[model samples]
Target chain A: MSFVRAEGIFQSYGRRPILERVDVSVKEGEFISIVGASGCGKSTFLRLLLAQERPTRGEIRIAGAPPATEPGLDRGVVFQRYSVFPHLTVRENIVAGESFRTRWGRFGGAARRAALARADETLARIGLDHVAHQYPATLSGGMQQRLAIGQALAARPRILLLDEPFGALDPGTRLTMHDFLSELRTETGMTVFMVTHDLAEGFKLGDRVLVFDKPRWDPTDPDAYGATITYDFDARNGGIPFQTPEETLHALRTPGPDPVA
Target chain B: MRWINRQPGTALRAALVATPFLLLFLAYWIGSEIRLAANPSDRLLPAPGTIAATAERLFTEPDRRSGQILLWHDTLASLLRLTAGVAIAAAVATVAGLAIGLLPHVRAALAGLVAVVSMIPPLAVLPILFIVFGLGELSKVVLIVIGILPFLIRDLSQRVLEIPRETIVKAETLGASSGVIALRVALPQLLPRLIQAVRLSLGPAWLFLIASEAISADQGLGYRIFLVRRFLAMDVILTYVIWITLLAFLMDLALRWLSRRLFPWAEAGL
Candidate 1:
């Protein structure tokens, strides 16, 4: 079985089908990005992975556990909004993962040492060690997002679910976070499943990108907004390279905000 | 910026705005004092000089005194009732907040009833409680509790509910059980708001103590106010009113100090 697998996943909200037998698979330690326009069931798919929502007619297995029940420590998730607790300090937020685990009478000293070590190391990676004791409100938006990333990474989960974690940042800060995530993923080999609307962000970070669209909603009209998987391929692994043909790139760059991808 | 609000010298602006009211208030006090002096009767409104002497005799002379005087007796009685009521209300309301906030169906079923109960003015319940518990501390304490518990529970429940969904999800995804998430994630977010709620509850409680003691009790500021009221002694009433307002002001400031000490980040302006 794949490390993270969704076999023919289908989701419907009140008789309106959003995902119709959508299937996507991420191997161990692989980086998969889902890119689509707004309302294409990207967040719904992440919710399915996070076990916040169950698919209407399919199964998602995370390291041999069903996503519907028994949420394991193997999956960590970060979102675009309110990911960090406003009242908690950075160090406190990072160590939240360890607070929930059972050490069986042995976790106090050694487990503490290990969680601290992980927190310190992740703080360094996220470049937020200077403000480790500061609350989230004191930090900038970029820093808060990085702190959220730090908390998610602290537990060293097998797979990470990132739903537009950087979608709300300025272009410069978004680039910086992208660089941090790329390097962190490379070194730690934490499998990442990301959802983003920015084409360039998806292109630069995705080992493979899944494009989705919702068919326009109409009972009789067949295109009635049923979430359909548009493009699914290993863009970097054996799948055809999506070469934009430099001429087209050069033509696009000549004007109009420099064609993002 | 609004014309009145955004000005260079805030102190000057505030003083300018307050000057008229302060003058009127001072004028009234002076007018009352002048009226008392002209009357030459201590029973009506004691002259400022005589009232000062009365206040000094009533308060400062008893500086060495410890257990019960007007100042000590009223203060101690009010504080004791306030503390017991606040403690019981906070403890019970916090539990109710958690149970009602965390459980959706539970809140939906009970919220309407809580709303109904909270609407009936708390002072109205005193007569009923007095009949049941007798005109004693229990009646006053239970009255304060009934007055404050509904608000404490309602405010805390809403604030607890307002905690972002992501924080809970983050904890659960990392293997936190329901209890752990509630204690760690939920409680911390709820605390600052709860402190403000407690302060709101305290204001009415201080009012209730004086109101409850007005006709029934033999001691307390309300009793003092009542004693002076028999002779149209407005000076004593005014003195007691100032004293009670000051006490409330000090209590509120103390609560704020405690909040700042415990949660320093909240105090630092962004």
Candidate 2:
């Protein structure tokens, strides 16, 4: 059985359909990158997986159970914008990782000390120990994003979702984040689903890549129809080596003759 | 020329701030002098020396009938009413604002009412409050609360609503219940803003307090000022006015200091 499964997922915002009849099955510990054009419902799909919003039709099951109606500790998410609580210092923000396990979102006595120590350790691992006392606002953009990622990881979620998590970072910082994420995934063997605009980022980080698009686009009835998964690529064994972004775009635009066949 | 664009040092900034007050004082002093020169006993604006002596007497001397320092008694009475009114307003506003901001149904029900209530000039309702609560401390406190409560609720609701959707979602994914999110995530952010809202409302709160006191109270700063005005005791009235201004300034400063000390992380964004 798949670790996470979605069958005939359909989503809409009032009269506007955003996703239509999409199906996805993800294995445990697999890294999947979802790539698509803007407004192609990549985020909508991720939201469905996280259960931030319910699918208009069909159901998503995680670990043999239906996904919760709301986001919960089993799923941790990082967005392009830093998600750290601005009112909390770096250390406190990290300690918030244990918010789900602790009673009333608080830790006390030995548990408090353990939580603090774990937060400190995560801070060191993320190379942010020096700024543990600083608030998120005082940190650099790269540092803030890193702190957010670290905070998410500290929660020990079963799956991690990223929505253009490195889109705002500079090229150097973006590369660093990619490496950090890859290492973290390898170390923890956590399932990762990242939605990215950059095709190269998706290819670099994902073992499997899913492309979403409107197969039958109708300009007049844009709201009536929504996107679906157009192409699925097993990126692990593709013969294409080091394609330029333009080449990658070309290959994705016209996925030639179903290589999987 | 050198100082035109450059930021001022601490002493220079202090002097710059002090300059306006000094000029205003000079204007008052010169006006008082000219008025006194024209007439030895000007009742409208007393000389600075007369105001000072009145202040000394008010501060040190006991009242003939009550054997209590009238200034202190009035100040204490006025402050107690102001504190009670503001504290109740803050508490009620925080809870109401959080509910209205977080729950769509509550927001739908109360948002329009809040807007309409806020638009109604609070002073216009003073008579109603007096009639309802009676001409006691309750009425006075209710006046201040009614005057500021709607504004506080509106400002705080807007503040709570302005909390980024991402933060709430993140808190939810972190396994925090709705109650936990409200108490921990939302409440902490709202507190600093509550202090700020109170600081902004202080002027209005004081206005309502004084108006209520002047209309009915036997002993209060505003009551004393209004009473002395009938006798043309300009020195006593001016002294009370200055004292009121000083007290208001101190209260604002104290609230600001408390906000900064308690929530240092809040100002980090600034």
- Candidate 1 regions exceeding 4 Å error are A70-72, A103-110, A216-224, A237-261, B1-11, B17-21, B42-50, B62-68, B268-270
Among all candidates shown, the one with the greatest TM-score? 2
lDDT of 2 by residue, B1-270 (tens): 586788989999999999999999999999999999999977888888898998999999999999999999999999999999999999999999999988899999999999999888888888998899998999999989989999999999999999988788888778888787888789989999999999999999999999988899898999999998899999999899999999999999999999999888887542
TM-score, each model?
0.88, 0.91
Worst 10 residues of 1 chain A by lDDT: A98-107
Model 2 / residue A224 / CA error / Å: 4.7
| CAPRI grade of model 1 | acceptable
Over the stretch A1-261, how does candidate 2's per-residue lDDT look in tens digits?
589899999898998889998998999988899999999999999999889999999899889886689898998988878488888889988998786445588787898899999999999988999999988888878898889888888888888889888888899988988898878787889999999999988888898899999887778776668999998887753425345366555685685653322
- Docking class of predicted structure 2: medium
lDDT of 1 by residue, B101-199 (tens): 887888999889999999999888788988999988888888878988999999999988887788778877767776776776777667777778888
List residue ranges in candidate 2 displaced over 4 A.
A101-103, A220-224, A237-261, B1-19
What's the TM for model 2?
Answer: 0.91
User: Residue by residue across A28-104, what tens digits does model 1's lDDT show?
Assistant: 88788888877788888888888788888889987777465644577788889888767678887888756665432
- What's the distance in Å from true for residue B124, model 2? 2.5
